[model samples]
Target: MGAASLVALLRYSDWHSWLGYMQQPYLWRVVRFSLWQALLSSGISLLIAIPVASCLIHRSFYGRAALLQLFSVSMVVPTIVAILGLVVVYGRSGWLYQLFDIHIPLYGLVGILLAHVFFNMPLAVRLLLQGYDLIPSGQWRQASQLGFSRWTAFRWIEWHYLKKVLPGAFVLIFMLCFSSFAVVLSLGGGPKFSTLEVAIYQALRFDFDLNKASFLALLQVSICTLFAVVVYRIAPVNRQDVSLLAVKRYSLKDSFWAKSADALALLVAFILVIPPFLAIFDPVFSPIFLLTLQSAALWKAVLVSLQIAFPAALVSLLLGVSFCVLARFCMARRYLALLPNKIEHLGNLILMVPGLVIATGLFLFLRDLGWGFQSSYWIVVWVNAVMALPFVLRALMPVMYQQERRFRAVYLSLGVRSWSRWCLEWPLIRLSVAQALGYALLLSLGDMGVIALFGSQGLVSLPLYLFQLIGAYRLEEGACVAVVLILLCLLLFYGSTRFIGGRSLVKH
Candidate 1:
């Protein structure tokens, strides 16, 4: 589907007409806005994440575990819920302005940046902190003994660890910011501040300009693909953890300063995180009528989400598993090893090609393929299954790799075939498989792209249903549905928690 879209795009000659429109002053302005906003959002998120990660690694203060958990809480919150929180907190009649008389605009580039940072910062902090936690405490102590200042210690130890993964982290965050859809579609007040994804959406859904939309989609995909490739190439692939065995210790010198810095970092994290929780919670408890719970349409949407999510999760897991196995086998075949690192690259590439672009591309491709079953439902399900591939890979591959390293010899001696291998290995790696399924469910449940493309009389997922509620000015009902959606996510998260508890059953 994606390949056909690219092929079709290349065949056009009046590239001049499309290129000219792309180069138009307004489009250039939009591109510049998206670029800088993404950069700044990623920067601000990293800033918020780093100090907190540093403090957590260095200091074992009160509620230290809780603080770490706090940092992690935002990692799984749905984007739709996050946006709703932003609306309640910073919107026209939000509590902030009511409490402080400070009216902040929540509908422009600043709002978009805040939302992006909100969604992305926790991921950055967690990733970077994993690096920090891996650095040996001995290195820190040795540096301190050598009269190395805080900056100097960071320069030698933290800097190197951070540098190893920084490009990849930045690239991932940038790709996320670049392809932001729900945030832009909801909070982007006007077309002037739109992104390429939003532009593609507006072109197709609102303006109905097929030629212009297709042109813009091709351009967006090209730019994003190039950036993804460059960033992946620049990122380091191998660097072992140094702090894995580091002994935890309380620092003696300058405890006051460390405490103060830690407190400040906690405060900053608090401000960034607390609002969304409050926003999501406040509406649920507020004397708002719970009409959505009574509506048959809401139940239908829930059922629809379950049907799509279960199959999508299973299918995505299968595709991800296949990709992982293929990559593992390809390691032995020198010629195949020389091919593009598709397994590693495809996820980010998919992210680069925004959901709308993929949906549009898939729609066109399916239309061209002359499939007998041409319902929009199949398109949504297939694209969604593909979209869930990245989450599955991220969750599953690490476990699979670890298992292969630990038990490869045992399995090789037994001459385990494919089905037998799965029977043995799946139990050990069930945690990762479960995590992948949970992530796939959460992601697809919230997605609006596929439904938007092949939208039908009866088709509705939670996000699409939420969109309809919001469109009809049923804010209170929308909030209720949002709460239900969030609870479903929490249920998934809780189920994943069992994997952590059962980790002891699987030997490394």
Candidate 2:
């Protein structure tokens, strides 16, 4: 798909025209804004995440475990839903605004930064916490025995693990922010604040400037590809560590300043989490919220969303499995010495391709092929599957490699067929498989970019429906849909994790 899109761009666009378009001041502004905001968002998220993760590591507060789990909710929450929730807290008529009689615009760069931090900061915290959890307990004992100060412990011990973990986390968050579309669309206010992804959408969808859109899409792809290469070079390879039985930590010396800082960090984390839940739950008891439940359009959208999500998730899982299997097989047979690296590069490339770019490419390709918007349902499924591919691979590859390492010789010696080999391995990797499926499902459920582009009046998914409701100034209905969407995604994720196998191996 990526190659086809690039070919289409090159076939139609002249080099001189593309270079001229690239030289425009407005184009530079878009590029500048995109890169600048992404850098700031990633940096700010990591800065906040370190202290929050550290506090969580050292403190045993009530709801700490639940709070950690809540961090995962950001992953599944639709961007529009999250933006709406943020508006409810920070917009002109929001709770904060009403209480303080202050207007904090939930649009432009401010909104973008706020939205990015809300989504990515929790992810950073989770990754950092995982890193902290992997630290050997004896290391903490050693630091304590040496009478290390808080600063000494953090600098000598905590920073050591974080140095390895933070770069990857930063890169992941930066890429996510770079690819942001729904948030930029809903909150950017105008083109002045637009990112490259949003600019691509505008060029194609609104201006009908296919040539310009193609050039911009190619530029976006090239920039993302460069970032992916850099990330692959810099990020440390992940190794599966046996779960730590217990994480030991030296008790902090009692101090007022320390307690206040921890309290403040927890408060900020809670602030990040509260608005989304509030946006969902607080509207449930409203009179119009129940009325939305009876709307036929709501039910239709739910059915359409389910139809798209399930197949997309399955397709993504299949593609990820096929990639892992092919890579493993090639490596085993020495068929292609660079197959593993190529496969890894492909996965990273997919991770960097924004959904908007994929949707734009498919839309153009299908239009050229005479498959009109009538085939949008299938197009949506295909794009969602592709977008979900990276997550599926990330979740499954490590386990697959581990299984192959441990079982390949045994299976070969016994002359095990492919089917029997899979059966033997299924029990061991089922949990990871379930995770991959759930990740894909949740991603498809929350996706807005592709559907926003491809959805017709006759075929509206829940995200599209919710977006329409918000656009039509039906906040009550939008809120109701947002709540239902959140519940549906969470239910699907939990069900996939719990019942996909008789015994679930997911620990956290």
Candidate 3:
């Protein structure tokens, strides 16, 4: 079938003519620009996050706990909300540009990088900090007692721990940037700087070039699948310990550098964290923001978002539960679950598929079906579900494992039927379910991809509507909507995690 498709592609069909454009120097230029920007952005975010994470882990200061919580909150804010703030702050009319009188623009590759960093830096901090948590407190004190310098202590103690988690972290960040669609779409000033996902969107949505879209989608899938497999192979094995230690505390010595590092981490964390939150609030007092409270369209968009998000979250939970069960009970088929006894690979695989690729492929399949439901609401729901499944799986996997181990003898002695057992086991798994559903809802709420394709004049999710507001230069309304979106996502996340992670995860 691929051979036939290749022949058809080479036959100079009208739609396939765009294949020549793919090989054109200008297309490669866009590809080169995207690659460089993603690499630069990911590298810079990791560099900044690593030291700050180290400081957060290695020392204690006033408000240290508060700072960590602040960072965690930043990690959950939607990309649209964060990037909207970046635009308002760094764009031509923004406070910084006007204050500095700099004519430079933050609307192209530079804008994309800043937005990516703003969205991703907190993730790096959290993951690396978690890595730091894995290391015993004694290791650091031992190195200090041995008279090791800061560099020596980090090189000997922290470096090994960092190494254990670094590959997974790097891969996670890379996949995020690689598949990054919303930021690139919003910040990319024109077609000059675009990722594969954006390119696929242009092809499918604007040009209606299905052949070209299919080819691009295939290319993306092949590249991402191979990259995921390679990263999974090299990822450190079973590096995360199941046991949680007593929270270790540290007091920074009264040295100039120690003081400097803490201050630096605090400053960086604050700068990265604060503006988006305030930007959202700033719009609330505007006339348009006030008017939006009475607008039927605003309420409609909210209802649409809720409808998509709820079903998507439910689907994600169901899929995640099935996956968890298959991995747990079907021991021999466990290898079919991707990485055995490890959470990283399965999560990475789900994360690696660029949102655009999945949306494009499904669009084509539906188009070929010539069905009436192609542009219906269900497509958005399914795409959101798929996008969210990985996160759901990640949240539930550990909880499922712990529950299984905790109740193994009890279940075995009772000869619990696999499907019926869940009736009795649901309470133990409820927290995990909550966490999974919470993440799924957030994912769906923030999604702008599939809906962008299938969305019509009559159908718009909140993210798509916000994009339109930005396109139409309704910044204040966009900001207000952004605030509303963030709040809803936070509520879902908080409620779910509060239950899922309560005594079970904490007791560990």
Candidate 4:
């Protein structure tokens, strides 16, 4: 589908037209802003995550476990939902502004930065915390026995893991922020602050400029692909390792300043994460909650959201499993030695390609091939499945590889073929499969990228409906929708994890 879209784009757009669009100063501004905001967001997220992760690592406070779970929730919260939460805290009529008579401009670059940090910081913290958690208990004991200073401990022990993981985390966050569409569209205030993703939307939906949209899509692919290549070179492929069972810790100074810093870090993290939880209450108390329940459109949107999410997630899981199986088989056979690496590269490439770019490419390709607008439902499903591929692969590949290595010899010796092999592996891999499906479902449920382009009155998913409610100045109804959407996401995520052996799958 991606290849077909690119082919159509090249076929439909002329080199001269692409050159003309590229030469425009505003186009360059869009590129510049995309890179600038992504850089800042990634940098800020990492900077703040380090201390917060350290605090989480060292301190054993009440509610610490619940706080970590909240971080997990933050990682999967929908982008639009998170943006609404930010507005409740920082908008013109928001609590902070109205109470303090202070304005922080929730509709421009500042808002963009704040939103990106809110969404990505938890992810960074979680990733970095995992890196911290993986340190050998013996190493921690040695460091403590040696009375290593904080800086010395960091330099010798902590820095090694951070240095290995941080680049990948930064690249992941940067790609997310760079390709962002819904967040920028809702909060950017106008085109003066637009990114390339928004520009493609404007060109296709409003301007009806296919040439311009195709050119911008090509540009987006080029930049993102470059970043993907760099990440491939720098970030090591993640592997699951058997580790010592004992919990380990490196004692901190416990001095006044150190305690104060840890307290401050926790405080900052609380402030950053609390608004979304609080925002859920707004619609519950508001009269709009009843109205939203009574409204048929709300139910229709919910049904539509489920319709898209289930199929997309199922397809994503199947593809992820197939890829893992194929890669494992190729590795075992030693046939096509580069095939597994290429497949890995393909997953990275898909990660870099924004949903908007794929939507644009597919839209152009479909239209050129005489598929009408009605094909958008399928398009949304296909693009969303592809978008979910990387996550599914990430969650399943490690487990699949581990299972293959552990069982291959046994299966061969026992002659466990076909149905027998399936029976043997099902118990081990079911949780990973469920995890991938759940993650994919959450992603599809919250997506606003391709849906923003293809959605119509006839086909309204929950995110699209929520966006509509916001656009139509129905703030109360929008709040209600936001609450419902968030709850549904949490319910799906929690249910899937629970059904798939609960915390075991979640940890994986």
Candidate 5:
């Protein structure tokens, strides 16, 4: 990665090109808008999340778990599908226009902000909810005995921990919004709302300007590194505790105002996430649906998507498990010290290197090497794998380490070595492994970043095909494709999670 960064830097080191590009007012506008929108998106997401999280912890109602699951889905719901869903509701001739006769300017900054909030606010709510779990039950008991009002309890008890979580959550959502691509591309409408990621893609794919692409990638890396450092330093980890169910404050009676506020916040979150998803299903009944299904191009794109997803997922799982094993081995010795921690951190550090930046670097390098589109296939896979690595490690590292810690001596004493050891361990951790792999597969399948830059007519994946369909305003066809993509994501996600991991022995 360092070598790629340096190579990108050196290739774009010509001061004249830098000065000329920097002189363009449009570039500065993009930079400023990127920062401004990210700030707004993060700030807005947190503002909304705080109340929602509070309501959730204050009261556990029916469907709350499902709502939390839905929140998790927002983060991984295939960007193009989410964008298409958004367009269905907020576009000029969409749901609002047809039903209410309201036309939102859904093609520009407004749409961009809507899309960012739709994708990110639920994530903020989930993260903030975790912060609530960190609060001790004793505090709630004290509040109950003292007859604390909702506001008073929140001010004195909950706010204390929630504030600790705010900085990390804000930075994370900001980084996601800053590097956003699919939303910007679909709804940005034009250069007025483009982000750095979009600008980098334009330079590489449309303009074919290697120097410009490299320069943008370098800038992106520098900014991302600053935020990544903050993330590392803050290191907020909000784990669930069983005590979250304890000591519901008896003093906190539901007032009409509190009920109204919680209802509104939850309604806002529900409307934000559900409508777009439901809207995606609109075309399933249309005549174009069957036609799209029969189209060879659609099927071919599906095949191509699988072609990328399978290998990319395998590579991610292999790399993640390998890192966990090595990290655990080092931890066992204790002399190797932070080698384990460093390895764990290095695996996640992939997040700081945005997918497009990595692709841009690889794209530039491949061009210099005279590599053709044949090898671009592998490059896309490699980039997608790297992009999913952090998630895979997040799923695997804890479970993998725990299995080793609990079972290592037993397995060693019983002479479970090599193949025997792996077989023994496989079932124990396959649930996590399958989940991680499933996530990687979905990520690779849904990716528009690497493939967008490398995509050619001959190399179209499902997402790129759907993107093209949406771009041409073929709503009928795009809806059909969106349904297929969503089904594929869910099917594969569960197939791996349930079938590969086997059903949980724990009775629900």
Candidate 6:
């Protein structure tokens, strides 16, 4: 992953053209719009997420469990599929128009912001809600005994919790929105709204301007790398519990007005998050659904998607395990302590230079080498695996590191070695491992970035196939494919987490 990405970015140097490209007005627009949208998206998501998480934490509601689950779902919905749903609801001719004579003009920055908030706000809420679990019950008891009003309780208690988690969540969401591709590509409308990622794609794919694409890819990498360094310097106030299910929280009593406010927040979040999913699935009742489902091409795409997903997941786990093992080894020793963190940051290099940029860089490199279409499949697989590495490592590292720190000496003295050691360890690490594998698989399966560059007659994954269906103006077929993709992702994620992880995972 490191070699290919770095080599492709650097090997074919055209510094003079790159300098000229930097001066282009189009380049500045892409850079300015990319940063602006990411900033807006992150700021807006955090503001909304705080109140929603507060509602979930303080107010007991009838459908709270289901609503929390739906928030998690928003995080996993394929980007393109989600955009399709957003378009169906917000486009000039969509549900809003037909039902209420309202049009959102979802072809530019407005649509991009809506799509980003839909995906990210719920995620931000989930992360924020977890922060409350880290707060001791004693604090809540203290507030109760002090006869603290809701405002006072929030100031002393909830704000403290939010302060701890908010920065990390904002950084995560900002990186996501900044490096966003599909949302901007599908909803950006045209050049006026294009981001760096979209501009890179257009330069390489349509304009055939290799110099411009390479320059843009390098520029994108530079900006992300700067942010990654800054993020590393700012240590997180707390380590969040990564859980798939809704967290169980201790209840807080609210006054009628407070309860009303919480209810209003929940209602807004529901209206924002749920409608697109419902809109996308509405095609299930259409007459053409069966026709779309029965096509051999559709099945072939599914098979291809699975083939890519499995191998990519395995490879991700292998790399992640290697990094964790090395980090654990480093942490166990005194002198090599800093190396462990530095090693982890190396895995994060992929985040700075995203899969799309890498794909373009390699596409440029491979074209120079005269490689044919057959290479695209393996390239996609490799990139997907690498792309998934950071996620896999996040899931595995803390659990593995904690186990080693606590148990290594005990095991050594007891002569608990090899198979026995694994037996002792499996139950402790299995859930984390299973979740990591599931997430990696889901990411690869739903990925549109790598596949977009490499997709051909022989290289169609499900996302690529769905993109083609939409491109041909086949909305019914596109929705069918989208539905299948969503079902496949959800079922696979559930199966991996439930069966492999041994039970439904609940954190506090």
Highest-scoring model, TM-score: 4
TM-score of each: 0.86, 0.88, 0.83, 0.89, 0.84, 0.88
Off by over 4 Å in 3: 1-22, 60-70, 98-104, 136-152, 229-234, 242-254, 328-338, 341-347, 363-370, 398-435, 499-508
* Model 4 ranges off by over 4 Å: 234-257, 327-342, 364-370, 398-433, 503-508
C-alpha lDDT score of every prediction, in listed order: 0.71, 0.79, 0.69, 0.80, 0.79, 0.79
The worst-scoring run of ten residues by lDDT in candidate 1 lies at 499-508
Alpha carbon lDDT at 23, candidate 3:
77
Q: What count of clashes does model 1 give?
A: 3
Give the per-residue lDDT of model 6 (tens digit) for 19-44. 77777887798889999999999999
Q: Which of the predicted structures, 2 or 4, would earn the higher TM-score when compared with the native?
A: 4
lDDT of 5 at 50: 90
- Please give, for residues 34-72, the per-residue lDDT of candidate 1 as tens digits: 787788888888888788777666666677655444444
In model 5, the runs with Cα more than 4 Å from the true position are: 2-9, 12-16, 129-157, 230-257, 323-348, 363-371, 394-434, 500-508
Kindly provide the TM-score of model 2 when superposed on the true structure, using C-alpha atoms: 0.88
How high is the lDDT of residue 283 in model 1? 67
**lDDT score of residue 5 within candidate 3:** 31
Whole-model lDDT, model 5: 0.79
Off by over 4 Å in 2: 130-153, 234-261, 326-342, 367-370, 398-428, 501-507
Evaluation by TM-score, superior candidate among 2 and 5: 2
Q: What is the per-residue lDDT of model 2 for residues 348-431, given as tens digits with 9 covering 90 to 100?
A: 566566666666667667778898777788878988998888778766776677677666687789998688888888887787
| Cα shift from native, residue 26, model 1 (Å) | 2.0
Could you give candidate 4's per-residue lDDT for residues 1-508 as a string of tens digits?
A: 5666666666767778667776799999999999999999999989989988887877788888778767767766778888888998988888888888889988999999998888889878977875775577888889888887666777898888777778767877888889888889989999788999889888878887877877888888899888767876877654433443235576855567667878998888888888757866577988668878898999999999999998999898888888987887776676575577567557746756667667777877778789989889999999999988877875676567666666777887988776677778777777767767877998899999888888998779999999888889998889889999988988987787678634563321
Better of 2 and 3 by lDDT: 2
